[model samples]
Structures are given as structure tokens and as C-alpha cells.
Target: MNRPGLVASKPKNWSIFQQKMRNFKPQMRPFHLVIVYGILFVVSLFITLYGFITYSMGFEFKKEYNAQNGQIEFNVELQHSISEPVFLYYGLTSFHTNHRRFLASRDEKQLAGKDISEDALKDCDPRISDGIGIHEKYPCGLVAEAIFNDTFSIYSNSSLIKPSTANIYPSYETKLFRCPNDDCSSQRVNVTDPHFINWMRPQPFANFRKLEGVFVDGMPQGVYTVKINENIQGGQQSYQPSLKGSKYFVLSTRQWMGKRSLFIPIFALCISVMCIIVSIFYMCVSRYDQHLKEDYLQRHSMKIVQSSDKRQY
Candidate 1:
């Protein structure tokens, strides 16, 4: 008897569950699907545009080369907007001829610090008052010593002339403006040598200036390297944990990407186009199906009404 009662109660509960399920309706509609497809299409378009822009910009090539007896041609472009004088240190490396191993020099590491400044070189020998001291060693100041020493040589292929030791002391004239209260004064300084300027100069900004020619019998027809030793210490001394300067190296004539890079933008554009086509196809199919259903319903209702009218007549 209890088994029969349990079976009966189970049927009643199942019937009530079935009734609830029959009344439940899903909220998802065709409009919701359309909106989702539109969002996806928009996102894909943006990605395609980004890929195209990046591909158009092209990539920059930077490599490092050890200073050694080799021939190199550099076509460099540099821009300097800052007021400070930038010292460019060039030197020959002591590496094996066939090794071609380019290693950053210890002197380059020392120049890569922020602790060095004009104030630090205040006691530097060969001061402006001392005149141009043509000596083997500078008593003080790394900048002075590096510039004065004939440690490196660059022979121009076009002119077929070697630059004099004194020619390294090149300068340019620029107008500097200072504002005190409402009064403004402008002064021009012969911005040639960094040693002569006494006031605290701002950080030197450099861009590729130009490439004259190659090193005489340097490296083969491959990517070569050149290290730039910057001797300006702009940051505070206390902030620097170690007393080192800044030396940066760049690899030249090296393309960052190959022919495969062109495929990236093409693939992105294809994906975007596919998404648009798919969305449009689905939208058209959905509208067509909706129209067919409405036509069928209208024809069926008309048939039922005609039958009722015939029955009434």
C-alpha cells in the first residue's frame, strides 16, 4: 500500500514539474544574436586596422659592433633638441680578427652612469684657462681624456681625408632664453665643446646625424654593430647607487622583420571580412525565414476564416 501511494505521489510531482517547464520561455531572441554578431564584427575591424598601421610603419634596426679594425658604412640620422653638449666616444676593440665577437667595453660601462656631471669635472685638468693641452693623458675628467686621446680613427671614403684631432672639437651656435619674473633675456653660446660650458646643461638628446662612410675593411656584407658612449651625467649623484656612465650600442643594416611580417595584416583583414560576410549571411537568412513563416500563418488563417464563412452560409 505504501509503495502504491509513493508511486502516485511521484506522478503528481512529475506532472507539476512538466507543467512549469511548459510555461517557461527562453529570453534569447534573434535581435540578441544580431547584436552579438555586430559587436564581433566591430572588434575584428579594429584589430585589422591596427595590424595594417603597424605593418605600414616598418621596423627600426639597431645592433652592436665592437670597435675594431674593419670597414663599415653608416647612414645615420640624428636630432638633438636639448641644450647640453653630447660627447660621442669612439674606440677600437681588442678582439680577435676572425672571432667577430662584439663585447661592450669596461670603459663603456663606466660611462653609462648618471653620477658624472659638469660639477664633477670642475677640477678636471686642461681647463679652458689651461688652453688646449696636447698631452698623452688627461689628469682629470673622463670626457676630456676620451676626446683628447687618439684612441680611434674614422677615415672618410668620399673625401679620402682623415679628420684632424682638433677637428673633433666641433660646435654649433644656438639661442638660449631665460625668464626671470616677466623679464626675458636671450643669449647665444658656441655649443661646440662640452668642456668649455660651465653652467648646468640639460640632458643631451641625439638622433641619427648622418653616415659618411664605412670603416676601412671592417666586417663583411652583414649586419655591423657600433656602440655610442654618452658621457653626460644628468641625474643626482646621491640617487645613483653605483658610479657608472651610459653607453648604448645599436645594430645597423638589420631588418627586424622578414617577408613573413607582411602576412600579418593580410590575415587580419581576411578575418574581419569573413566576420562581416558571416553576419550578413545570417541576417539575410533569418529575415527570409521570418517572412516565410509570416506568409504561411497568414494563408492558414485565411483558409480557416473562409471555411467558417462557408459553414455559416
Candidate 2:
């Protein structure tokens, strides 16, 4: 009797997308394992050591300061004579400029010195309209409005430590940003300033530094005072003030790797360790196989000798 959902006999069948495969394990070879993995271990170990050594050689000094929007001062005592092309930077903590909404809050056309119309700045949101929503800002955006307006100057024994005048920012960027429509008819914001250019670009990290300026010849071993004219809210009279974030004064020499990171060296160390472990495993397997081959040959030779003696008898 034939069942409703069962068959008495089965038929051969195959699917077009179906595939079957079997992998065969080859005999372990000691020489290949040792040579290949030994080279990998050596190369990766070298990179791990080199990366850490170079990263630490760069000079860096940091000091935390009060979140003051007014004048502030700091006395920096150097431990040693820093190298040429030293940088001065200001950092902010707990301010995430990389948020999806925060990063996109800018009018590229408006910042290029073109007169962007008031109605076209939908991306700026609340920043699009002024405090009362009566008038619109020229380069209407949260990024432009929250520009870190702090200025810094270094002094050694009252002699001003002048920063390098060479433009650190791109020429096209610095040149392109000017007050759209005749200086925006205000004194509170200077769109032509390079600091404004730096602020417009969003940072990847929550806590990051923006370059204040650079000292091309570097500084001699001595104490220096820094004067800061702090203006966190852009010193705007009409604009709403933002939250006061912590500030840090950073003096760092250019590192071989542009930004400071430990991921590369750590990654190299991990890879090197893995290569050595794999090499050891294969090496042990090869040694065991060699022993088995030697033992079988010895037993066969003994059997042949025994048979020859029996034939003589």
C-alpha cells in the first residue's frame, strides 16, 4: 500500500545550485612550515618594534585649563629643547562634532563666499534663523556659529614668540572663505580668518585638537608663557551661547605617523604570535610522522634478517 506522504521507491534527483566537495589533508612538512612562518614572525616582529619606537620619539606636552570664555594664561616649562616645526593646538573634550546631524550642518556654497539665500539653508536647522528667527546668519550653520575663537601667543621672558606666518590651511579653503555679501556687515565674526576654516571641518573623535599655530624653528629649553584671548561662543552678542566645554593646550612635535595611534604596532604583535603558534603545531606533526617512518623501516629490516637465517637452517 502506498502512503499519502511516502513513496515505496525513491527516484534519483539533483539540484543545479547543489555542490559537493571533499578536502584531503596533506602530510605535514617541517622545512616548509619553519621557513614560511619563521619569515612571517620575523617581519611582523620587526614592524611591531619599529612602529612603537618611532611613535614615542615625538615630543608632546599637554595642560588642562579652566573653561573660561575670558582671558586666560599658562606657563609652559619645557623638559628639553623641542625639534623644529613644533605645533600649538587647542583641544576640546565631550564635544562630539562628528554626529550625523552636526557634521552635515553646513552650507558648502555659502562658505565659499557665495551669497547663499536665506530660504536655501534648510540644513542649518535652528541655526538657520538667528536667536529670534527674525534674520538669518550669512553662512548659516551650527559649525560656523560655534567656531572656537580663542587666540594664542607664546612669550619667552616677555619677548613674543612669533608663530610661523606660512599658511597651514589650504589656499583654496582659506581664500574662498570671506564674508559673503560685503563682510556680513558685522564685526563679531571674521569669516576670512583661518581658524574659521579649521572649525568648519568636523573631527572624527569626540575629543580632538585644532591647530592654534606652529613654531617653525621650534623652541629652546626654557619656560614660556601663553596668553589666550578666549572666545568659546564667538563673542557673539546676538547669537545664543553654547555649552562651555573643557579646553586643553597641546604642544606637540610632528610624529612619524601623522596622528598618534597604537593599533598598528599591537596588530603586528598579534599576527606575529599567531604565525609562531601555527609553525610550532606543523613542526610537531612533522616530527611525529618522521618517527613513525623510522620505526616501520626498522621492523621490516629485522623481519627480512629473520627470514634469511630460517632459510639457511
Candidate 3:
């Protein structure tokens, strides 16, 4: 005979198991699951669309130049309007040449008044002086002076092209200097335009002001070539050097999309497709499982009815 305590504990365990099964019912219906998957798929699709729009909304033009007989030449085909001022930039992969004079001028202060002391002008002086009145001026020391020295001629196959005026304006800075008067000991003066202050800096670069006038809009579209030649004048009359082997030179209308611009759209599209595929697979599996459960329940109910009929008979 079993003990009273052991016999009573078996019924309590069975009751607990029945209660757990009742509480463990599926939290969501098939319709609700399908709705969730649909929402996720829609969100992924929106992400893909945004990326595509961002990738398609910019214009850029690029060309490469190779030196031929100590001269560089390339053709540029304009596809957009150059109604606004265009900027010219140059990038060098390796700069081993002696650009110390240019670097010094960039750091020099542009002070006002012609009667300033010689020591104050020495930093900005593009000329090499021996302090005994013997001085030699070099054009390669400053960006503005260097660009003027290297004359660039733009030519087009069409006769409608017109020449535009280009000018180089100096950048200025404000400084307070000690004055002779006691009432006002210091006075503010405008200094140089620091060449080091530029967005596309750390490389040898220069901007040809009013470059857009050279390539205006509504002009006949064709192949245009810019001929770059070094003018031998003053001290440069000895050895005339061209801008060959300068590594990189870019002529762009404005900032536009780069190669990495398409990466976002492509990546978003791939993720969207994956999300859609996963949702579809899960929906199919859920329907199949639902059908299997319904078939099993129907068979179980039929057996219960057959047993009751046998007992009644």
C-alpha cells in the first residue's frame, strides 16, 4: 500500500502541469505575425529608396593628363552649366621639389604701408636679398605670383568661346601694434591672407579666380583644351620649367558625388532584399505549422466522438 502523502503529491503535480499548458498558449495569431513581417519589409524598402536618391543627386567631371614631350595635355567635355564661379585645384602625389620660397610667403604677414621696416617686409618678400642692396625676385614664392607667371591659355574648337578676366585678391588679417601715442598705445592693422587657411589644404593647390567665365553656360559643347606654359621673365629667363610630373591636377566645376556615393544605396538595397526574403520564408513556415496543428486536432476530436458512440452502443 502507498503512503497517503505520496498518493496526494501525484495529483498536485498533474494539476500544476495542466495549468502550465493552459498559460503557455501562442501569444500572436497568424494574421498578427504576417502584419509584423509586412511592416519590417516596408521599413527596409524605405531605407533602400533614401540611399538611392542620395546617390543619384550630384554631378562631377574628371580627366587625367599625361606629359608628352615635356608638355601635358588633356581634353575636357562639359556636360553641365558653369554659370557660377569655378575653382581650379591641383593635387600632387609626391612633392620633392624645392617649394620653400612659396611656403615662406604663405606664412608671411601682409602688412599695410610701403614705409614699413625692412625686417617686417623680409618675411613676405618674394625676393632674395644679400642685405647689401643686391636682391633677386622669384615668382614661384607666392601662389598668386606663381599662377600669374605660369600662363594658362584656354582654347575650344568652337569660335563662340570668349576670354574671361581673372584676378588674385590677397587675404588679410587684423593685428594690434604698439603705437607712439600714450592715448592709444595699440592700433589694428590688416595683415596677410594666410595661405595655410584652406579647406583643400596640406597639398600644393591654387584657385584660378573667375574660372567659370572661361567656360560659360549656353556655349557650344565640344572638346576644350587648356594649354599651360611657363613664362620666362626676370630671373626665370634662365631655366624655364613646365608643370610636368606634378602628379595630379583637377579641373572641377564644384564639389560633387565621389565613387563611394553609390555604396550606401547598394548596401541598403541588399539589406532590404534580405529582409523581404526572410519574412516570406517565415510566413510560409508559420502557415504550414498552423495547417499541421489543425489537422491533428481534427483527428483527435473524431477519435473522441468514436469512443463516445461505442460506449453509448
Say which candidate scores most in TM-score: 2
| Model 2 residue pairs with clashes | none
Write the candidate numbers in order of decreasing lDDT: 2, 3, 1
Q: After TM-score superposition, what is the CA distance of residue 174 in candidate 2 from its true location, in Å?
A: 4.6
Q: Which scores greater on TM-score, model 1 or model 3?
A: 3
Error of 2 at 224 (Å): 0.5
Q: Estimate each model's TM-score.
A: 0.32, 0.73, 0.40
lDDT by residue for model 2 (225-309), tens: 9888766464442322354556788888875666556788899999999999988987898889789899999999999999999
- Report residue 250 deviation for candidate 2 (angstroms): 0.8
lDDT assessment of candidate 3: 0.46
The lDDT values for all models are 0.37, 0.77, 0.46
> 129-227 in candidate 3: lDDT tens per residue?
333554322211243233223434556774334444333222332232112232222322112222212311233433122222333343345677766
How far residue 180's Cα lies from its native spot in candidate 1, in Å, is 61
- Relative to the unseen true structure, what is the C-alpha lDDT of residue 171 in candidate 2, on a scale of 0 to 100? 70
Model 2: CA > 4 A from native: 1-33, 67-69, 165-167, 170-178, 181-188, 234-245, 260-263, 292-313
